[model samples]
Target: MVQESFEFVVYMIHACATKWNRLPSFVYRKLAESGCIQKFLVPNYEILHTQSTDFVVSDIEEYLNVRKVAI
Candidate 1:
């Protein structure tokens, strides 16, 4: 389930980038550096050996909030 959520987020990011004619890797790196992506995965590293779904969801929500503020 966690993997599925991660994949879904990745796919959405890629799709949005592609729609905007941006490079997915570049966008992904930018998001990562901004703490908008992938950072949540570390929180549950010990327990799940992967990111917790809850953490990932919260991270995404926080990312959206940040984006809303920036815009």
Candidate 2:
């Protein structure tokens, strides 16, 4: 990943962790297992990284919800 995308991934991981009241590692695992990191976030980084953090977090939550992924 490019530097910016890498940073965004890290930021999103922490953001999700905080919003979900989970640890960063747990957030990372959930995202990875659900393919959110690779299939969603990173692929959409150009546009997504430009949005507000809450917006992105909401998007992530929606993605997981649609997939019926817990956490």
Best by lDDT: 2
* Per-candidate local distance difference test: 0.54, 0.95
Predicted candidate 2 versus true structure: per-residue lDDT over 1-71, tens digit per residue: 78889999999999999988999999999899999999999999999999999999999999999999998
Determine which window of 10 residues in candidate 1 has minimal summed lDDT.
Answer: 40-49
lDDT of 1 at 39: 55
Clashes by residue pair, model 1? none
- Misplaced by over 4 Å in model 2 are none
lDDT of 1 by residue, 10-60 (tens): 764565466546788765665676666455433433443354555544455
Error of 1 at 62 (Å): 11
Error of 2 at 24 (Å): 0.4
Candidate 2 lDDT trough over 10 residues, lowest sum: 1-10
